[model samples]
Target: MKTEPDAFSLEDLRQRGREPWEGIRNYQARNFLRGMRIGDGVFIYHSRVAAPGIVGTAEVVTTAYPDPTQFDPQSKYYDAASSLARPRWDLVDVAYRHTLAKPFPLERLRALPEFADSPLVRKGNRLSIVPITANQWDRVLQPAR
Candidate 1:
């Protein structure tokens, strides 16, 4: 999942150990969070920085649940349309796994053969939670292997 480093960095997850990944307002991104299963691996990407890249990894520790932020008027992510019975947003808790020894820069990943068809590498694609193919996953972890 992608986040602005200033808002939430890989270090933040490491310090907290685990966190509820909330505030997902996009329908497509919300669906991806809902589809996550316990123990599933996730790449932690730092976006909107000088050097955007995958900084670390995390593990899904909880299945999908309604994001409380969507119902809280105090929250910036709050949606008035969302209700207790029919929530419009969902989130999953993820635990820190490891920080990559060397972060995978977006520029490098875009040039790789494995990511040729990945939405992550496509120009103008802005989906925060993207599905990575098995091959692409392996390639991303190859350096750490």
Candidate 2:
């Protein structure tokens, strides 16, 4: 999932071990989070940085649940329309797996035929979470290995 380093970096995830993947306001991204099952693989991507790329991997430790931030008025992600009875946002718990041997820069990924169809390579595609096929996943980590 793509996150700005200023908000949460791969190093921060490693230190924390696990954390709730939260603050997703987009409906499409929220659906992606909801679809995640335990043990699902995630590419921890750093976006909006000088060298944006996938820097590590993480595993889904928990299935989707209500994002608590949506209920807290003080939170930036709080939704006035969201209620405890029916939350508008959902999140999953993710545990740090391992950092890639090298960051897979977006430029390189775009040039690879394996990822030519990836949403990440599409201009103006800003969904934080996107599904990757098994083949695509393997191709992405191959270079890092």
Candidate 3:
């Protein structure tokens, strides 16, 4: 049994520079935040666009914090009533690593017997953030190895 890697698009990462962390309205994604520990590995993914796959790696920079978007009524992710006193969601800080020479494209993952059964590469499953097992982590990175 393997949990898949969560993917982040290039645009989303660029947004990080502007807003830090925002637009995560889902609780599961939020939970990933709450559970995240500093130095945790991240598989930077490209989603909601053409050519999605693991493009780079990221490192957790900070522990969970109240998501400011939940407090801003004007913001899209705003929870309307959440506040510093009682926050609803949280997020972690992640920094980008150098891009992969050959992105572990979705096709490649599906072709491999090991990754074929992976939850991340499977169709009809889209989780903004997924947990990567120690072994699964090695597989994606093996190509670069």
Residue 47 of candidate 3: its Cα lDDT? 60
- Put the candidates in lDDT order, highest first: 2, 1, 3
lDDT of 1 by residue, 77-130 (tens): 999998999988999999999999999999989889988887887889789998
TM-score per model over all chains:
0.95, 0.96, 0.79
lDDT of each: 0.90, 0.92, 0.68
Segments in model 3 whose C-alpha atoms lie over 4 Å from true places: 1-19, 113-117
Question: Candidate 1 local accuracy as lDDT?
Answer: 0.90
Which scores greater on TM-score, model 2 or model 3? 2
Q: Write the per-residue lDDT of candidate 3 for residues 1-145, one digit (tens) a residue.
A: 1112244354455556422445666777778778888888877776654566777677778888987778877877888667788888887767665457777777777787777566778788756777777676778787654
| Model 3, total clashes | 1
Which residue ranges in model 1 land beyond 4 Å of their true spot? none
Model 2 stretches with alpha carbons more than 4 Å out = 143-145
Model 3: lDDT of residue 26: 73
Candidate 1 local lDDT, residue 59: 93
